[model samples]
Target: MVIINVLKIVNWFRVTNSADLRKYDFSEELTQMKVMKLLYYVQGLYLKLYDERAFDNDILAWRWGPAIQEVHDKYIGQREIVGEISEQDLADFKEVNSDERLAEIVEAVNEAMGNMSASDLVRKTHEERPWKETEQSDVIADDLIKDFFDKNFKVSRE
Candidate 1:
């Protein structure tokens, strides 16, 4: 349920940000690959800043990059651009929208990474310590991501 909720929030972002992303050439046709990497960065940065993971799902080192199995399966052949979230769930998870710091992190990642092609995103994730250390299909530990981002980015956990 937590993963579903997080997926909803992330997918909602993909949908809502399509217009603004156009200038960066990351229009509405966001690929599954791009979405997954964006989610991974969001999780990593959120963990770095807040000392907590944004989602409960394990981020696995899939062939391409970090991915959530359930979310991956849901969008295997999806071309809908964005996944749906119930109004009640959206209302209940106000923090996904209202947390100003989290919003900034999400926007920064989306803006920075959104225009990348799927292959480029895959390569970028592969360079990440968590993904590199993990074997294919293995879970990328949240602590690893947190430690890497904290050390490399010097992001204050304020």
Candidate 2:
């Protein structure tokens, strides 16, 4: 079962990025690396929290970190995602955000690591087993992500 829709999640980030810039006063817009890393963390956290895979898409271990090819392809040649969120994009984001659990997972990930730089997220993922063990360009298995998060991830309610 496809628990998470990758495009919807991406739209969520795009929409949220705009809001976050104002809410948090972020100087830089979300880059591709930052979005990918956030997606990876959301997938891992969802797996740990729900004992299920978030999305059906395979996450590849790229030179930077875990990356979804679809995302990379979409944002290729873009330095930072800076644009108006279209009506369709906003609707798609609303669809994703309607799922309370999934929205919470996304919110938690953003709150925890959204402020971190792309390089910081890359370094953090590189230290994790899924990225470290998977060969470059190979898919980082969901089971590996689940296992690693089960052992290493700690939930905080604050």
- What is the number of backbone collisions in each predicted candidate, taken in the order shown? 0, 0
lDDT of each: 0.73, 0.87
Question: What is the per-residue lDDT of model 2 for residues 63-137, given as tens digits with 9 covering 90 to 100?
Answer: 999999998888899979747889988997898888888888988898889789999999999999999999999
TM-score of each: 0.78, 0.92
What's the true lDDT of residue 51 in model 2? 83
Q: Show where candidate 2 strays beyond 4 Å.
A: 156-158
Q: Give residue 85's error in model 2 in angstroms.
A: 0.8
Looking at model 1, residue 1 earns an lDDT score of 17
Best-fitting candidate, measured by TM-score? 2
Q: What's the true lDDT of residue 16 in model 2? A: 86
- Model 2, residue pairs in steric clash: none
